[model samples]
Structures are given as structure tokens and as C-alpha cells.
Target: MTSNSPKVLVFAGSAREGSLNKQLAQLAAKRIEALGGQATFIDLKDYPCPLFDQDIEAQGMPDNVLKLRAILAEHQAVFIASPEYNGFITPLLKNTLDWLSRPYEDTPGLGLFAGKWAALVAASPGGLGGIRAMPLAQQLLANLSLTVLPQPLSLPGAGSAFDEAGALKDDATGQKLDALCQRLVDSLAKTHG
Candidate 1:
């Protein structure tokens, strides 16, 4: 059947069963579904890649990188559930971006990221929110030719935002997340259509 909705992919950088960021991503996807938009939450656990090194890249990008770019090419926009690692992005997310950006001068395969709308959402148990990581993530997306959304969704004290089943539990947080999804859809439609 033909789909009328714009497809968006939400990547959850963390794979932990209790990942608060993942929970946030799930909620964002639900919001998109509610708004008549299609959403797919991509769990990082399913994507595998070797550690990134330019020397390693010179040999050839791993097949996983190509697969990831293919996945990105199918989506109109992206929402990322980033977790902070030492006040920056998780190494896995960083590695994924590095691999996707591997096509230089001669090689082809720069789908997914270029001209795509992206939003950064970070969650941590700490009081400061994952604020330090958001800017860096935005910069990374920018470097990849993505248009990072100016307003981001950050769940401070994420420990309190989800239930045991990983569903968003707080009403206010739910509303905020819903709004973020709407913002992403609105931004993508205006930017691409």
C-alpha cells in the first residue's frame, strides 16, 4: 500500500534496557504516529560497525556504514536520543556519524544526512540535563550537512520521567515530547515540501 506520511527515523544511541533516552525516543515516535506521520525508532544495538579511523576508512568503509546510509536515505528527517559520555556524545553515535561521512572526493554514498532535518534530544539523571552534549551533537549533525533544529528536547532528571516499562510517565514531559515531534514534522515539511 502507498503511505501518505513522511517517514522519520529516530535513533536511540543507547541500548541499555533502562535507557532513559531510548524511552524518550519511543515517546517521540508515538507522538509522530499520533500526528499522522510515520516514525521508526532505530535501536543502535542492531547496527554494528568497526571503530572509526581514517586509516581504516582508507581501506574501505564497513558494510554496516553503507547499510546505515541506505536507512537514512529512506527517511525525511531524524530525531536522536543521545546519551552523554564524559559531557559529549556516546562513542557509538560518534562512530556512526564518522562512518556515514566517509565518502570523500572519489567515493559515492552521501545519502541520509545531507539536507535532512535533525533534532537532538538528550537525557541524563543528572540535574544539569545533558546540555553539554546537545551542542556538540548539533555541531556534528551540522558537519554532516544536516540542518539541526534550533530548539531541542532535553529531559533533565530522566530517572523520573519513565516507568518500569519504559513508557513516558510524566504528563508534562509527555506534552513536551509531543511538541518536539510536532516541531520536527513541521520543520521537515517546510524545509523539503
Candidate 2:
């Protein structure tokens, strides 16, 4: 498509198959692509990092961590859908971000995240709709110097929210996600287009 669309990276905190967070992240990716933007959908499963350990880092960063960092740095915006675990971000997501926050050679500190735009979305089977996870994730991204979008998507009772085809069954909820995606794209263009 001959469109002025920014590159966006979309990912979920969970690595398990059939995770609601993954489904939501995919939906966000589609929305971005539908707007003529390039969306790179990444799975944390592909980039496994041991729990953050200073000793491990003192030796050297993992290949997967370096690969993930390079991939993230290519994008202008990020869309994240994190599953809530005991009212917090999943450990996998936290560790990945921790690695990304570290300095890399030839890049400024927080190179993967600095000046990037981010939007958060979450899906949970519980009543809170994964809203609780957004704050910590938002704070982390903000600390990395990303301009986080204030509005977020929290899909409660998400177990039954998607259809067999994986699209949100409720049109209204889907619309909210659409808006969030558009805002991310627009915000990125304003800053980095």
C-alpha cells in the first residue's frame, strides 16, 4: 500500500499458545496494518531470556536479547498486550523489558525504547480486565523514555470475548481496540513520521 504509515511492533507478554494476550496483540497488529502501517508481530516465546541476573549480563547478553533489541529499535511504536498474573505483569514480559532497558554498544542508554511511542492493551478472564497490569508496564516504558498513550484496552472476561476466528465478538470492544491502535499510529507519526 502506498501509504504514509509508521512501523509498529506488537507483542504479548505471555508465551503460551492460545493466550488471550497474544490474541489481543495480534488484533492490534491487524488494526495497525489495516491502516497501512507495517506491524511486526513478535512472540516472546521466540526470544527466551533467563530471569534477569547481573551475573548473566556481566558475562554478555544473550543472542536472543540482542536480536530482540535490534528488532525493537527498528520500530517507531509498540503495542503490548500483557496478561495479568496476580495483578501484575507476567514474569516473561518483565524480564524481557528489563533486558531491553539495558545499554547496548554503539547505542544510547535505553536505545530500544527511548523516544518510541507505546500503547498498552490487556486481556484477563477476571473482572478487572487486566487493567491492573497496565500501570506497571506503562511506568516501565515511561522510564525507558517512551511516550505512552494514556488510553489503554483492558478486556475483562476475555475468555469468551473472542470468536472462533479470533476477532472480538463484541463490536464495541473491538472498536475500542481500533481506536487505541489508531491513536498509536497517529501519535507515532506526529513524533517520528
**Which candidate wins on lDDT?**
2
What's the lDDT for residue 2 in model 2?
Answer: 42
**TM-score of structure candidate 1:** 0.88
- lDDT by residue for model 2 (127-163), tens: 9999987899899889889899998999999999999
Report per-prediction Cα RMSD to one decimal. Answer: 2.4, 1.3
10 residues in a row with least lDDT, candidate 2: 1-10
lDDT of 2: 0.88
Count of clashes, each model: 0, 0
Shift of residue 115 alpha carbon in model 2, Å: 1.1
Off by over 4 Å in 2: 1-4
